[model samples]
Target: MSDAQNTESPASENPLSAWSGRTDGDAPEHLRWHQVVRVAEDAAHNDADRAGTALIGFASDEGVRRNHGRVGASAGPAALRGALSSLALLEGTGALVDAGDVAVRLGDDETPGDLEDGQAELGRHISGLLDEHRLVVVLGGGHETAYASYLGLAGSGRVGPNTRVGILNLDAHFDLREAPLPSSGTPFLQIARDEAAAGRTFSYAVVGVSEANNTRVLFDTARELGVRWMTDETCQTADVTNVRRFVRDFVQDVDVLYLTIDLDVLPASVAPGVSAPAGFGVPYEVIHACVSEATESGKLALADAVELNPGLDVDGRTAKAAARLIHTIVSRHRAG
Candidate 1:
């Protein structure tokens, strides 16, 4: 069923109360985990009394369909929620809110343009959350989520030409395809074009790019757009210190930061449930450390994780890995 008619899903139903797990009695009192998390029913009620982080899910696969990738990513949000529900909260557990999802639907009369509409809806929701001083963590349905994520940052009116927003995407592909339609592989290019049209800077840096995955045309496009990137060949544990320095330098150049992680950026052994699993992707330790460092830089305004296909996942490995990354970023944000 289309997301519009299936309003009973977590997106429209009780957003806050969608997913809840048992609180382990053995767990310490002050060390209570997300199982006992404080949830808000709506965005208005979220952090109304305080300023903190908010968790929002994006459950759509239209862009994956367009990209001819996997199809089960629509279920990614719920899987991530389940994995995160029982995890221990290391810090700043006071004002976390699960704002449900921006579920996409194709109207009976609506054309394939529903994809664009869905992204616009996501942008509006994210803009509202950012306006309220909430650090939003978006659980994504596809890499296409980046366009909406970018839109939210741009639409918030908080940024301007002089104050460029930094975008750090950790993924396997450059996702710079010039397709006739928008797909999972075109969000960053679209953002670059939009920035150029608006006369704003497009400060984008992608880590863990696979040389074999992206074509020469895509590489040219990245250069034309002035995108900074680190190839998977050099993203080893020994290189992590240099990687941290690179990330710190990037953070210094922009006023704000939006970090997006495509699960496919990890090795297939670590994340095999993505549309295109990596043969030699970056290690979780390296990625996590870099992300934590960036979050610690105090400029990580928002973040998201995408491309998790539960149908393809084995033993929920991808979901759990994605959840851990989210945990690190949120926890570090709280620390910062």
Candidate 2:
């Protein structure tokens, strides 16, 4: 990636200008994320320990368009940041660093940018950030963000042929589609193939799958690949004992974990602003429990929340939900 593509520089205007909220006080306890966040460039120059959360934005919807889904998820990063900015901060939440965005620029003729190149660029940035920050949270463009996230982990020098890495996806659909090219619906399968080529084990699990949404062939493919999953109906029970156990077992079995949240996993009534809202989705409490369980495991290295289409949002409800999940992932994350 070129230096021109990296917008995290301090000399540039603050990319987090969206991070504005009421100022309660100058003290740490009174501060919100906006008051505490610094640009990546600023963080690098400072003497403070780089032991906090680093946020990067993937501003591309090319994958979603290719998957024949709604096209507005490209704007998810800014919307998430806006939602997160005003949230109250706790004493030990650690420093927040905004690493700016890896954006897909449009051509003069208005054609879409290359999704493959954008994912590759995002991987390079994520790999670099993994070395400096305790936790790296990618604010996403679409489900394709997960594949780029996988690239970052593969290149971070932490995983090898023998290392067991787990991927936990929270979504209403199984994104294991067969396609001529990569798209929002094909990332997990791409990861599986990539892992196989590298002689690594592909440990993947999905929660909140909608049986009616995914075809039988997809289910057969998932089973053939040894993917573990729980349906939306299964996750809707008031008790989360099974959910906790499912996440706990996955976390225990892998040396490292990557958690990805697709907002469509939640009921459409709860999260209407997604490329494809769920007709029968997992409840918010169940999803929250899953995230909390994963982050508390100490093996979580990277996490992302994707598929928030601001154009379809109802009063920013989806953004708020996504932000809440992100907040939990960052605040509770323990580096492996």
Candidate 3:
């Protein structure tokens, strides 16, 4: 049963698996990682000693959020994998594993149930993966994965002095919208409530969301809970020097920091493949600055780069940019 023998699952043997192969052959050539991304036949299970950092491209398009079709981001995982796999970070000493995409049923052109199915399935699968890896690089499927990623890591571990969780979300939407009963838009709300019921504390923060996109209701909820964040405009207007210092100072004693980047936070010019594009955003350089600064600060236990829609991408621009961000993170910590 172990992956050592390298046997394919019965699902892989099906003709449909081969029949419905990837049509995205046009990966970015300019980037180093895309050229080398392998279609991993085996879901990566690394030796604990060999485990450097793990990036699981969790692909799911179905979600009942506000704008599903407007942003074609389900293709995020595969596209990003192509970019990350090709990188030779720090002379190839980093151990990177492409935990294959988590499959979700994308509904017909218009259907709410299908999206919920995708969100639920993603939550279950990602929860299992968190048990294994120290660092998880999540390529967009949707913001739903953030709550899934958070809940997965939060569910098992009891918070001790060593246990800490900090959230940094970069997106135009607050994603704090009330769960419309039960759907993708409400994962974080549900997660926060669930964690509270379980006698746990989940401290979160968001970046990039503007007042117009995120209603005052969500802000009030977040503020009441003590979840602090820097808005997209704040991040954009501030000098990188001051922002880096702010980010470093903000996450000083954090044992686990979960970073969520919604592609919508990026300007449409640089990254057009976002479901929710914002007019203003922090320059990617500032994100790099904060991440690099954080590395020197303390333990960056968990991070997920979410929300890039390859189906909506122009010249593979966003994918490449996100890939470089991944490289910077890996290179920052990867052994040369």
- In order, what is each prediction's RMSD in angstroms? 3.2, 2.7, 6.3
Model 1 RMSD, rounded to 1 decimal? 3.2
Which candidate tops TM-score?
A: 2
How badly does each model clash, as a count of residue pairs?
A: 0, 0, 6
Tens-place lDDT digits, model 3, residues 1-336: 111112232111221121122334544333344333322334345564234565555455555344444545666776776655555535432445454555455555455434444444444444445555445566667776676576546653423444656666656666766744443466567767866776657666666667767778988877877776777677764577767766666676456666677767777787777776567766777777766765545455556667777777889888888877777766575321
Q: Kindly report which residue stretches of model 2 are placed more than 4 angstroms away from their true locations once superposed.
A: 1-13, 44-49, 106-112
User: Which pairs clash in model 2?
Assistant: none
Query: Worst ten-residue run, lDDT, model 3?
Result: 10-19
lDDT (tens digit, per residue) of candidate 1 on 1-336: 125334333344555455667665655554434554444344345444236677778887878888888677778888898888777777564557766777765222235536787787778767877776547888878888889889988888567767678999988899999998887899999999898888888899989999999999999999998999999888888899877887888889988899999999999999999988999999988899778877888888789999999999999999999999888877667423
Could you give candidate 2's per-residue lDDT for residues 1-336 as a string of tens digits?
A: 122244453112567676888889988778888888888867854434367888988887888887889888878988999999988886667778887777765222255557787788888778887777777899888999999999998888667778899999999888999998788999999999999999988899999999999999999999999999999989976658899899999889899889999999999998999999888899999999999999999988889999999999999999999999998887777665
lDDT of 1: 0.80
For model 1, the stretches where C-alpha displacement exceeds 4 angstroms are 1-11, 25-33, 36-50, 106-113, 334-336
Compute each candidate's TM-score over C-alphas: 0.91, 0.94, 0.78
| Deviation of model 3 at 83, angstroms | 2.6
As for TM-score, the candidate ahead, 2 or 3, is: 2
